[model samples]
Target: MTTAPVQKSSYDRYPTVPLPAGESVITGAAAWHRVRDLAYERAEDRPPLIVVDTYPGVDLPELTRQLAEAWPTAVIIDVEQEAAKPIEEIDARIADNLTDDRVFGVMSHLRLNAFYDQERLAALAERLADRTAATVLIGWGAALTATRPDALVLVDLARWEIQQRQRAGAPNWRSANGAEDNLRKYKRGFFVEWRVADRHKRDLFAKIDFLLDGNAIGHSSGVVRGPGMITGDAFRGALAAAVNAPLRVVPFFDPGVWGGHWMQDKLGLDTETPNYAWCFDCVPEENSLLLSDGDHAVEIPALDLVLTQPRGLLGAKTYARFGAEFPIRFDFLDTVGGGNLSLQVHPLTDYITDTFGMHYTQDESYYLLDADEDAVVYLGLKSGIDPDAMIADLRAAQQADHPFDTEKYVNAFPARKHDHFSIPAGTVHCSGANSMVLEISATPFIFTFKLWDWGRVGLDGVPRPVHVDHGAANIQWDRDTEWVTEHLLQGPEELSRDGDVIEERTGLHELEFIEVRRHWFENHADHDTDGTVNVLNLVEGDEVEVISPTGAFAPLRIHYAETFIIPAAVGPYRIRRTENSQSTRFATVKAYVRGTTRTDQEGPALAAGNKGVRS
Candidate 1:
């Protein structure tokens, strides 16, 4: 069968939700001028105090300079310099969480106030209270300096942007370790800085006077880089709109040792990069959300939507279970024209909880998007393989100059387009070369325990860290060839079919909390969120349209390989072929929390049975 050539540049790198009408976003000089006006307008009685609380990784010096330039006579206080604990002291306090391990760390419970000197904070607050001049306080913990401010502006940066800045040699907040390894910097941000900042920022969301887009800063001329500012009410409205409709997080691509040419060619990414290995398409913790007001869009951490509207976005049960976390993650693992992924295993739930203080583990699956004739997937282990022998070889491979004998122990299954491999936690697995993979998994994304890396160094020329001991402990020895074929290798088990739509249950393994479904439709497919969020990617065909049956949301067009999310509140929706699509049929693989129930009210014929359609 011949298929039309996939559209070039069909993948949307920047997906945004439209803000309500009349919601304006100001940027650059206008944004600065508006801050100046707000500072003056609220200073009728006391010294005007404008607290520009920032997420870590923002350019603080530049922000302070911009504020000074805007209000020449105002007193600008660098709150971190005045009130933050010394870098050495802060390091000592978070050392337990920031273990020497290169990749793993304990999630921190520390709040933003914990990183500041209480006495110094009091002194700064007192000093600001007595000052008669208009003062601007700016830093990560700027809001903590005042009980109430005349104008509270938050300069927010997305985690993905923060990572880019880290890659470009920016240090963690208040740390002078610009030369540190990017992984260690990321660990600090993930376990300590980001947690503390988000906790502090969440409380201020409703109280914020203005929201500034810090992700756009620090670009050279002709890059269209400038801070965008929106009113607090408008920002809240955008967040509400996002949770009530289908939306997408801004996707980001990165290169790796096992990178491929597919994304660079198909996704129209920068061709200059050696290869693009990973596309973090729906990892909300690290991705961003762009809120556009027709003309300008402000980028903020997508986690903000989860943090602020957990109920509306995640639904009541999921929010209650995960506690404001977007537990499901969907990303792309590209190995086409590249090397195999490192042999790895995720920790079991009990092990992860005991070791890292995380409540859940990375239960994941790999859905093949495209594969070459020779593509393969390393999954489970050869039947009756000695666990001790495998562990010893893995350990020796990590220390010595030899590559681990992969096929000797692990089962290598031939991978084909549309094949789904279920990889529950503790299942040893990796996507082999010449395959495009859509990884649907739980969101504890960084806890991968690599057993073997095929003896390759990273792009930085440093040997990638292999956790043989951790992998040995976590590997489920029982998941052998026979067990894997019967369990891990799953199906497109047809659940139901209407006139032109067929829905099938795809395996995420019964051990996992996530459920997957594949829908093949020539005309239209009916779907309901069933009181839980649904994430899907158009795995087949050029383009499709996601529409609300009741006009609950604007129709969203999804191209092949583009991932989008339907919030639990976006009850009933339909996916149909777009007028521009040339394909005879289309397929979408969707995922949602297992056991979520459908509402009493259904949409159409195919949506009648609760179990007939999943995700």
Candidate 2:
């Protein structure tokens, strides 16, 4: 199943480049040096061609002009000027109803066939490549056909920055948000196509010459050279020898109807927004990792790490199964002091593929982070459930704005701190009010079919749409109260214990592609990756430090309620609790790909030793 790039070559060996101490952001002079040095190395008759890859809102023309000033002999060409068709023509090519997620989801993945001609664009690059002394093509996909450049500068920007800049009437070239028409405004509000397209761009990291972080002004937040292909022990050495510490991908926050104030108060986040509903803690698809090379901290999309070192990050067997795609995700779903999350269910694997063009289903488990006394998790259906009756009731609740007897149809369980409730595809579930949930799930993040929303409007004061039919089709009618109670209420089974360090494994369902293990300890615990990526959270600790085998990498300091990853590349590591607590014990939940299969006469068993490995 793994389609990851193979056939090892010299490209796989990346040597560590040391940077000056106490410096973090790359200055304009430094950025100029990278390009100038590359050109000097080339020593060609024709000026070295440079490609600057930037996002929609970046001031790439300004950056190109700066480069031209730095190198008097260089020529700057903004690729937008050479577009095959007018910008207006491309803007008009967008599909109608861009506000609709379903519409945008499909259109985003499709080729830009409706807008521009790739062949014509390639021809334009070919022409421009020969015209200038040092041809500098600067734009999104500007150098699509211009073979390898003497230097490639990738400027990364965050989604929030793009949206904020767009709203502020900044100079952004995104055609969808260019004009002031009703359709354009509608498109601007729900533009996530860039988020998907950016994932495709990250795969080309091996081709990048210099990575410039543009999260701040001057595009000088940091810089990093292109990473070499990662494999085996070399991968471990790179991670252990990381310039700063174990990586913590930048987290993204979004508001929802069921958002709460916990994040605002605890994390000291801005309270001006409505509330923070979800924190994308470590989702590579939308998150970025900061590689601090001592002098500057370069921010690259998290997915690039997995792509560059799939076998090293995800182990050989797991990489073979899923390729470079990181199978597990750790995120926060906060409903504390807020409304209940919409009663939702994700589609089956086949259903997701057929409906959303996604590869897999969203099988998830909610590990309660914190909850109020009355908090509850609505899961599965009650005994003697009638599918037709439930559908009719849900329809009435959405259409007529009449609330249904939710408990009468769905089973509710008291959600306490650390309670784990499995919500695999087709299993109806939702986190009720006053609860902070650490949602661990598969990579397909947004296939939720909301059947009910407690008969309330969205935070925007608009009636949220419901997918009654979609929910009905995907609902697993067989997962009644009895099945849910017996199979979904995941409890820990002791794996191994050495003195005060106890390891327990849970979530042994056959439907899961990954396994969960909790490490509770007083001092420190050593664990092996077993050739699989490990995603973990300090759910019950004040703080902890993760140390690599050689201690070359700085120990990563993780705070309470923080999530981090130990790539498969970092083979063996130790997690030590750094702060003393009243309970004298801290707990961390670790998730990874299942190395061994477990199956009985009935199916996979959830008992101790039924699956494998104690520690």
Candidate 3:
């Protein structure tokens, strides 16, 4: 069904509770007077909590003074009602802590935004969400669509109509009592609320809130949190404020509904697998993406590589791309990941058209996540095998047993952690069973170069397409294996705890969008919700929040690390270490935008007027 267009309204009367760590909650004039008078009369049992006024882009001796003043110190940062700092610098300030036992509470200037950036917002909020019930994260925000008077009336009507539905069985139940009661029940239903985010669910019943409750829900919104943040450009100011401070921060997502999937139930494609190794197409069901450890398909420089780390689940990926303009948008794909992948090479665009009817060749790389001892990759034509003999082997199925026939027909390399193989357009390759991989490749520039087969049928009861004729035609005369073996064998340095990863860069995967990193948050993993989505992955069979990438996040409960994908399209998101419960071990993937290339939209060579974009 089409979404009811959003309508804007304001709810100025709504109220929210401020943090209550002190007598004032928020040290307002009233709070300050109480403390000031206490000190004057020597009635204060505890030292006074002084509020320091600091300037924007300003560094004061406040932190040092606070620490020197007491055994335990705290900082409350507030700028003008509308203010912020660069998210990166804000993060650096908050990450500095005395110890887990010493509390670290970093708050933004107040997350008062009006748009729903599901990925960015959710990633930021999830960071504060805890798996255990010990600590609860409190978020405050508003939700609104556009502006329209009639829609506002509809919202009001809906609120009244709902109250009537649930009040049906109430002792005071009566249709005349109106629908607002039903609206209350709607909010109380854990099941329904869980179906969508708390805010979206509320929005559904908002019409009723408007109709009977006197427009309690904002047309835009008042202060609030998670999922149903106020709608429109309202959040831009809030987000900007957050990004400007040395505060805990991250991206977020609004749990709203969206649709799109590539792995359709095709005549031959089988898109089902509890395991998501092949979900390049299941945008709605399960979404994943390919992330390489380099730039521009560069030379397989190092030995080890981390491809396709896991992001949370399907929601993570979708929300990340909401409202984004991408050259090649990615999500969890639909692929036949289990079983032995066919031995194949992808035909470059040149080979596809010249040798086969297909427009492009499919030369792709698989960043394996799992594998068995028998796991082997077939890359390239055997060393010195004759073309006719190779074709003969395909006919007799002779290559099946010998596998790597002439050192050229195929090269068998056992799969291991972070291994990479550069399959030239014609080098045939297949990933064996029991292994999971993050498949990365150029756009559909070519089709695969299949050289052999297990000749197996997928869940759909269909064998994959075989491009033997084209594969044979496009096979590189002399193939290279050094880059593949070297890249896979060496690269990813099992990172050490600098305690914090200040910043660094790697190959192709330009620390673009959000750069992902993994670490522990619970066990006091010295935590704070930095306002980022933290996928809870109990790799130790324990629960924890995280934001890694790939299929790596799961299996951790079964003992594999799980990932949380935080969308970057929105304003800054944050992650807060909820309670001091489980250990917070996770990989954080930071987001960045790639520099525009000739292929990108409106890049220089394009229409002259396209030079300067988005102000």
Best candidate, TM-score-wise?
Answer: 1
- For model 2, residues 1-615, the per-residue Cα lDDT tens digits are 333333322111111222334333455665666666775577477667777766556666566666677676777666666653565665455444243543224324533323346667777767765674666777666546455777777666655445445544553355544434322343333343463445546544656666555555343222234321111222223333432234566777778888997777666565677788998887876676655545434454566566566776677787888877888989998888888999989899888776655677788888888889999999999999788999989888865647877888999888988777777799898999999989888877756788998877665466776788888999999989888877776456676789999877656365777688888898888876766678898888677788877875667777777777777667678898665434467899988776532212122344432232212
Each model's lDDT: 0.86, 0.66, 0.29
Model 1: pairs clashing at backbone N, Cα or C within 3 Å: none
Question: Total clashes, candidate 2?
Answer: 2
Residue-level lDDT of model 3, residues 1-615, one tens digit each, is 343332232111111111112211111133223323433343234332222221111112332232234322322222221132343433343332211211111112112232134455445334323222111111112222111111111111122222232345321111122333332333322112112222332333323111111112211111121111121122112222222221111111111011111122221122232333342321111121111112110111000010111121112342244211111211222223345556666665565555333333344444443345566666544455577877777755533354434334566777653343334355556666555444444334224445665654433343434556656776665664553343322343223344543211111222112222223332323222233222222222233332222322111111122222232222223333334334444332222222211112221222221111000
TM-scores of the models, in the given order? 0.95, 0.81, 0.36
Runs in model 1 lying further than 4 Å from the true structure: 1-7, 219-223, 599-615
Off by over 4 Å in 2: 1-25, 40-43, 55-74, 84-104, 107-119, 122-126, 129-132, 158-174, 178-203, 217-246, 271-273, 459-461, 549-552, 579-583, 596-615
Which is superior by lDDT, 2 or 3? 2
User: What shift in Å separates residue 51 of candidate 1 from its native position after superposition?
Assistant: 0.5
lDDT of 3: 0.29
Candidate 1's clash total is 0
